[model samples]
Target: MDITSPDNSYEIVIVGGGMVGASFAYALSQSFGGTCPSILVVEASAPLSDKFLQPSFDARSTALSFGSRQIFEALNLWQILEPQVSAIHEIHVSDKGRFGSTQLTREELSVEALGYVVENADLGAVLNEKLKVSNHIDFLIPASIQQISPTPGGMDLSISTESKRFNVSANLVVLADGGRSPICKQLGIEQSKESYQQHAIITNITFEEPHNNIAFERFTENGPLAVLPLREFEGENRCSLVWTTAERESENLMGLSESGLISNLQASFGNRLGKLTSIGEKFCFPLSLSIAKEQIRPGLVLLGNVAHTLHPVAGQGLNLALRDIDALVTILKTASENQQSFGSMQTLQTYVNSQKFDQQKVISFTDVLTKLFSSKKLARIATRKFGLLSLELIPAVRKRFAEQAMGLSRKF
Candidate 1:
């Protein structure tokens, strides 16, 4: 129980115990009950804090779909997060070209809300707190993997802390490491990394209106701009904005003073919601489309950001990751009940096949949407205009897109 010591071995080893890893661990613990399997989590930093404090309240946030929220509830972490979460009740999509736009309401779909937004730190804290209460899960705070090797029947990992080295062996090893995962590369799994010419500038802004649980997404020549609903204090309403633009423009925008930045935002975006009164500190991230060529290997499987990193055009990156987790957990449940080896090639193949369609759907959708919205070529521009017009005119197509945006395309 001492933070100074490390567990010697485990039946399952997870690398990168961030939100993604935490999700898998929580699910596995629940599905198998406390007596399930010996598990150890090797995280990038200490259990709670490395560079940031617990519940850091950092600028990063995610729009979790209703489906994903259910997954959290199944794992018992949602109760801890629900109090801090902000529900998205409505959404509007528009474009600035000849093409018009379409709007969607939760009422149209007969759903309580479109989605929920929660701070990244709050989500992480909830997962870690559950792990703390789980006697079956061993928390390796502030450790990194020094070596990973595949044996004939199992995988071996050597992890280290400042004071000592620890050896861990698992029948199955899951890579939940974030994008550009060293574990994936070390296993010689190929990845397709397509760098984009754009960057996303993310920040929180105080709007004149209360947002009223509405989320706005406007497509522009540069890229798509999204305003997500968020809550700061008990009585206040705010929106978390992720605006994608060309690299140069993003740099310029990040450098602007608070007032100047608000002015520019107001100009680019008309007063539909009223003026932007104030802005929060801005953060920027390079955009890219990354998908692993292989999703599984002998005694190893990849999930989460380690599996695929899509552009944030629709904010479904994490949702897609949760889907992967959902499918994998289902496969594992069946295999365990049938007394099958979880890391066997047969089990791995089943997990891979179950996820093939969903993964392809998300990657392809984001790729095509980004290219369509960011194009400035005359032909491409005209095509997007017509596409937008179609969306406005066709109720069925608009509903389909809206449902997809709400992360309801697949029932699971």
Candidate 2:
């Protein structure tokens, strides 16, 4: 089955050229041949968008787990990212509930570091740099898909840019288009989702005391607050923060002036790291968990936020997306080599089967943990607090939890 437009031909067409999509494209390229898989990436943001590739004046950053670091290393993208990455040597987790508190240290697990803290822009720049040098992938910058339809053989995509329209076809179509996946909606892939009754407010902060490579997670009556360490700020130490709270509370916080907000934060957060005198402007995202009931369809598949978007409370969203990239690359490489129909129902089903256990495990774990911690119930509050307190006393349990945060749990 030749799934290609007569004018422009390709073996795979990936929608949404964000980091996840780019990673998948690069992975498939390497698996098949250094420069073999004919691919096209359509991104709402330009494939070569400066938003991520430029320097990091942005307040946004992400905590990359060790498992994700290894995956990037395997993909040959980490070396490019190393300079901008900051290692997380320790983590402190505590809950202000009816029970007690807990903390996890990297030394307890005999690991060099728990994970790495990196700005989103830096990671994107590194990935874009690699994508530019790759001979295998073709990036369709700043393009939008107007329509997507399944053909008897594979799939058809109609993409429009400012100046032109591109009609593309591929043996397999990957809808990496994000949470509100237009392709999935076009294909009628059902999804099950729930709201977390919270919002995550992200910002960068310059602390009075040096972080000293320690990250902190403090849970209050509102929601969890994560303070992640950075390498060096100008000449002092700084940290990135993700403060989760209810929508109303989030709005009120965001409404404050920088100094006012900082003052309020210092009050609840305490002077654990001395005074937090300054903070970058705040960004807010509503919290929700979404899972596609069926990630694969007749001629298309979903990845990243499109397939499953989880609560950022655990910071596993991108890690899970990377796992999807790995599985898709493996399956596609084998199929392409065997001359098998890449878009066949059989092939898509196999990819879905391989990902089921791992995907479900992550979604369930994050969802349950988020709900358990967010509950205000007296009983649940006590149990969760006790759970944290108990783990604090047991060295082994605390180590295990840290290992999990490092993305070294049973499931990848």
Candidate 3:
């Protein structure tokens, strides 16, 4: 709940109360039940009257894998979020103008839905409301961490608000800030980044035909394009589009008239969902693979994009981060029960050790998919063709691929 009077210390302090941070806080609180520790969340931006105006709750939509849905169900959040989501009954993957394509269906996985897509704003509203009602959490907004330093016992932080600045200490600090973090830079954390020299053109588009709850992943000579199904709006069949293209090409696409853009999209995407009727405001950002050099140190841990940012090819970025939150919360809960210092290297290392393989696998999977589909080499083209054919022809191969896409391969 909101705390009017600041405390000098907290058992846990979370930085950046965005999606990741808020999820972690809620999960941690639920896991501990009545014995929950004193938790504080410091967010730099105040909650806007309209969630859509918030940076974290903008027009973007996130594709949550089936496994991610299970995670939310465990947290008791799925019931509240289900109404705002569109379920994916099937995923269609193809190479543009290629000889092979494959489809993954919910029946094959024995699940009702393969995944669900929810607009960021809707998801943010649910999480923020939960934060405000949680008795164990002290929600602090319009507050910034001016400085963070290590102490013998834990970490010390200087927090700034509109009225005053104050010092607080915490046994552990969780950093869920976005990829571009000034605090990380101040703490001398280095990131290894590899730019793909491509920018993703993101916008919502209306189609003449219904999507039938099918998400499409199409690879073209330009780059990988994803069209995720969204709930109908105002009687129009809508879908979220992520089109990756070269830097120059993205600029050209952004400058096109709505009709011109629709024409170009029709040529690239074909008539799978019929004609593209309309386009929304276009947004673009460069693609990259960024991993922090260190995710865990004494008294501090990095979570979400602050730790690793991946390509948007398979829609794995947020799903993977959600899994990370599950693992971290479990480990911290155990530490709390055992009365061990959760911020100690031993405790933090245990969390890292448990998640190391999962993190690497997802990172590698996303990176490889981005590179494989982005290339036009003859050999790579043949390889992908065979890959798709194999997925269709072989049940074992199809099952394995579907598991990864549904985020069931790793058990958190």
lDDT of each: 0.80, 0.78, 0.90
| Shift of residue 336 alpha carbon in model 3, Å | 1.2
Q: Which has the greatest lDDT?
A: 3
Models 1 onward score TM values of: 0.94, 0.93, 0.97
Give residue 135's lDDT in candidate 2 (0 to 100).
69
Q: If both were scored by TM-score, which would come out higher, candidate 2 or candidate 3?
A: 3
| Candidate 3 accuracy as lDDT | 0.90
Worst lDDT window (10 residues) for model 2?
Answer: 1-10
Q: lDDT (0-100) at residue 206 of candidate 3?
A: 92
Please write out the lDDT profile of model 2 over residues 1-412, one tens digit for every residue. Answer: 1112223757788887676787787777767775366777666664335554422224578888888888888877788788888888878777763456665666777777788888887777666665666667777666688888888878888888777888878778888888887667777788888988799999889888898888888777888888998778588667899999999999999999888899878876778899896787679989899888887777788899988998888888888788778888888777777887878888888888887887887888788778877777788787787778778787777766676678877552
Give the per-residue lDDT digits (tens) of candidate 1, residues 142-161.
67887789987779998888
Greater-lDDT candidate between 2 and 3: 3
Best-fitting candidate, measured by TM-score? 3
Worst 10 residues of 1 by lDDT: 48-57
Q: Which regions in candidate 2 have their CA more than 4 angstroms from the true location?
A: 1-7, 47-59, 97-99
Angstrom error of the Cα, residue 207, model 2: value is: 0.2
List the candidate 3 regions with Cα displacement exceeding 4 Å. Answer: none
